[model samples]
Target: MTQTSNISRRRRTKQAKGGADYEAKRAELLRIAAELFKEQGFQSTRLLDIAQAAGLDRATVYYYVGSKEELFHETVEGVLDANIAVAQQLIEDDSLRAIERLKKIFVSLMISYEDNYPATFVYIQEQMHQVAADETAWAQDIMKKTRQFDQILIGFIGDAIAQGDLRGDIPVRLVENALFGMLNWTHRWFVPGKGMTGQQVAESFWSIFIGGMVPARADA
Candidate 1:
């Protein structure tokens, strides 16, 4: 290759490597920040704290992310997208019974919490309040996305009731809110070695749901 062509090739190669490295590093930084946010609330976390947790200096972090606020938003969005994407997939599975899909949604989320810090989800949910109190349109967008999952879940519960599984007397919206209330509080007490696996905890809790909603045996 001519000298100018050689220079162009070298520049392209360098840019490609830099882009790949940035992606990898960005993921690492987000992981550390997420865990830290879970350990401490978003307001309590600092940029330096994230850098130290990620084993990087402040300058490197700033090079990748403009500010802690930006990083927090990215991290929260990452967790929210990952979580709902999975639930959406399950909700859309036509082959699975709606009730089973419902159970799977709970089980899958418990696994996510078991793997990712439970606070990742709590962070996004708690942001709903902060954004709402500020009267920002951003909260409306967030809620719009959030209600997608709620609508899907409400449909699932309604299907179960229609199938004579859940009680018809109970409102679908009420059951939906109550189920989330249980899941949302898991962050407060769920821990890795607390004498139960994530799946076990999910199954146990889901059993309560099943018992309460499912019709009692005619003989009993």
Candidate 2:
């Protein structure tokens, strides 16, 4: 190979390694931030805390992320968006019955929470309404997606009621709220290594919830 070509090849290799390192460090920083946010919360966790946990100084941390708010945003938003998308898609799937879709959503979400770990729990713990009130664009967007996710569940529940799958006497919004209570409350007590996995917890919750929702058939 020509000397010039050899130098170009080496330069490209160096750039690739540099990019990989940057991404790897940023990912480490995000993992640390998520753990801290889950433990200390958004207001209490500082950039310095994440930096120290990641073994990066404050200024160095900024090279990977913009600020504490941005870091928190980074830690939570992707998983939240992915969950919303999955729920939306599951509800839209014509092949699945309403109850099936809803079950998939609940189970998928629990698996996601466990898969993402502290990050999803951190988002669960955040008061997005208060965060949106501050008028931060990212916060407002998160709030918007949260509402969209809720509406998806509500709509699915309404359909199920109309189809005679779920109990019709109970209000749709109430059912939706009850489901949210079961799923979102996992943040408080659902540790991954505890006897059951996320899917197992989800299945147990589904069984209990569905028993109430499914109306009993008329006796002869």
Candidate 3:
């Protein structure tokens, strides 16, 4: 290659690597900020704390995330994004029966909670406070994301009912709410080494949910 061409190629490579490095740093900052926000509450967590956690100066943290509230939003967005992706994948997979698919969804959700405990904790606490304080915008945003999950559950339940695998009399909304209550609350007491993997927990849930919700033969 000519000297000029080689220099240009090296410059392009350097820029590409720099872009990747920036993204990595941004993600690290968001993760650290999320942990701090979860532990201390978003309003109480200082930029300095996030900076210290991320091994960066406060100014650098601000440069990446802009502000504490923005960081919190980014953190929540990251978790929700992961959740949406998982739900989409579950909905798309056709190999499993509806009940089996439901089980996998629960398992994936529990694993997500376990993996992002800090963010989950922070989100829950913030949501409660938002509702209590009548922070309309925040509450609405939270509710919107919640409704997304509810809709996914409703669709699954609807499918199962159509397949004669679930009871049709139960309202989709009610079933969705009950299922979410059971699955989401596992983060409170679920311990990894306590003789139950996420799949095992999901199986137990399936026993109760499927047995109770499935239509009787006489009803068919």
Best by TM-score: 2
Q: Against the unseen true structure, what C-alpha lDDT does each candidate score?
A: 0.73, 0.81, 0.72
**Every model's TM-score:** 0.79, 0.84, 0.75
Off by over 4 Å in 3: 1-18, 128-145, 191-195, 218-220
The lDDT-based order of candidates, best leading, equals: 2, 1, 3
Cα-based lDDT at residue 81, candidate 3: 72
Per-residue alpha-carbon lDDT of candidate 2 for residues 98-149, written as tens digits (9 for 90 to 100): 8788888889989998998887777667854466676778778888887898
- Alpha carbon lDDT at 27, candidate 2: 81
Model 1: per-residue lDDT, tens digit, 1-220? Answer: 4754555565455546787777788778777776777678777889999999888887656666756766666765555577789877876688988888788887877777777654455464456468545545645655666777777778888988888878888888898877766777776677767888888988888988787887766798
Error of 1 at 87 (Å): 3.2
lDDT of 3: 0.72
Q: Which tens-of-lDDT digit does each residue in 1-220 have in candidate 3?
A: 4754555565455546678677788778777877787678788888888888888886555445556777667667677778878888888888877766666777788777667766676777565446445556765776677678767867877887788787888887788778778876775677556777767777688788877886777656
| Collision pairs in model 3 | none
